[model samples]
Target: MENDFEGRPSSEEAAASLRDLGADRQALADGVQVPKMLLAALGGVAAWWVAGAAGANPGENYEPPTSGWLGLVAALVIAHLIRRETGIRFRKMGPRAALVMAAIPVLCLILFSISLGLGSFGARWAVLLTSLSAFGLVTWLAGIAFRSALDQLRR
Candidate 1:
């Protein structure tokens, strides 16, 4: 008599199927790179510009990086569009990835604050650094989030 599981695919077959799916996903990822980069860059610049208005110090007319709501909106919008257009496999991100994504912008804000306190470059340079760094961090974290989402699909 045949065992009930005998006709079922083996573990190796399951892994191979996953690899095939992963390759398909990789092909999709390759196709979206240009649009993704463009959108991310736009978000970075928009966020940097958004900070200029409120970040300004009336005494010296210097702007430092602050929480970037406008930029966040841009990034979130672009991220939504890209997710739809690219069809990245985000099957099971769970809590960890969600927490990381949530924390990245806050961490960037904290870093910007730290940069604002540095006196070595004076207020003007500090503001510039803070703005640029904050935007960079946002984009960097976006990349990490995308990669993490991709990783979740493979599992």
Candidate 2:
């Protein structure tokens, strides 16, 4: 109030304030580091889910994999841990991040289906490859998505 000229800031002052805010956002985004444990946990969960296919019976009388539910629970726990570790809760991680996140589950499902096929053919050993693939792919994609989310915060 003491510094008010005409009960409001000048246009230049407003612009400068906005620039400062942007810089602050950028700094906050830059300071955020993705937790390695979060990535590994997610990757492990994905691998476990895909590996479940190796023991599943594909045809009639096939029982749904109980591992799916366990994996979902693990994922939820990871999400909570990530929030606590990061100290930032992202409201929206941007379109690219969203797409990458979506792709994770889709990729896992594809690998799981392939694993099921291999199991049906008695090639259960091949599921290990799919499980490893899921681990690597999920971890990489999760990193990408986290970076993209930070970029959104910078904006």
Candidate 3:
């Protein structure tokens, strides 16, 4: 038996279809090659999702990042599965990307003031702020690195 789609194609072949990977049905109906609106909308949604997950939560959690860790992990797992099933291009994520991804959650967790930890509401708030700042810095660096990596791949 012959399968039309034999798993993921090589980088060259994948690159050719990258523009249409995340496209919407409207573009397909319109017989367009590119999906500008879909790409923009997805980008905006992705940014908002990341920021919300990374930002502070409303619950007075005894654990700082614990409340969001499960949600974040779940989202990541779901995304991975969806991408695989949908035949999206899966890029090579090196140590740098893994480190940055892990850092986001761990950095936030560092602010957690346990029983023997930084002892006080005020100090906890301070730690929270510091954690947010550090997370922002790492995220900024990650954005640059991610963009550069994509540019290289595209080129």
Candidate 4:
């Protein structure tokens, strides 16, 4: 019975056969190159810097809010571009993966808003740093997740 079961092919094999597919590990890796990753990172950094600078300067209150929004937009765009270039569709993302990516920005925004509401002049620099750091952390985490997912897909 064990031998018969062994020879019959597992569920994974059955699924694989049903899909009529073969892995394109190398193609996937090639699609998402180092340069693209670097560009994404650079874009994230630029966004964070702009936000921090604007947030820190009281003279330009409008600047910080604008930059913060721009930064968030840029991060999402970069993430989508990375997904496209890597042949990783957003729809392909598992529920856990989607939650991780979505939570990052939402948490960061919440933190920033809470900090602003506290209202301490001396805390301006701290607020700026915190916000930028959150942005950077979230971006970095997303990048890592993307790469890891790609690696898995390659396998």
Instruction: State the C-alpha lDDT per candidate.
Output: 0.61, 0.94, 0.44, 0.56
Write one digit per residue (lDDT tens) for candidate 4, span 88-136. Answer: 5634555555666667666666665555543335555565666566656
Stretches of candidate 3 exceeding 4 Å from the true structure: 1-66, 73-88, 113-116, 119-122, 151-155
lDDT by residue (5-123, candidate 1, tens digit) is 55767899989988889898676555554345744674475456534633444337554444456666766677677767675535666566687688776666565555545542455
Cα deviation of 136 in candidate 2 (Å)? Answer: 0.3
TM for every model, in the order presented, reads: 0.57, 0.93, 0.37, 0.54
Residue-wise C-alpha lDDT for candidate 2, range 1-155, written one tens digit per residue: 49556767789999998999999999999898888889888999999999999989999998889999999999999989998999999999999999999999999999999999999999999999999999999999999999999999999
TM-score of candidate 1 to 2 decimals: 0.57
Estimate candidate 1's alpha-carbon lDDT, on a 0 to 1 scale.
0.61
Candidate 3 to truth, TM = 0.37
Residues forming the 10-long window of minimal summed lDDT in candidate 1: 50-59
Ranking by TM-score: 2, 1, 4, 3
Which candidate number maximizes lDDT?
A: 2
Error of 3 at 53 (Å): 15
Q: How close is candidate 4 to the true structure, as a TM-score?
A: 0.54
For the record, the alpha-carbon RMSD of candidate 1 to the native fold, in angstroms, is 6.9
Model 3 lDDT per residue over 44-132, tens place: 33333333333444346733434455545654664454445434443654566566656644544443322114334323334444444
Better candidate by lDDT, 3 or 4: 4
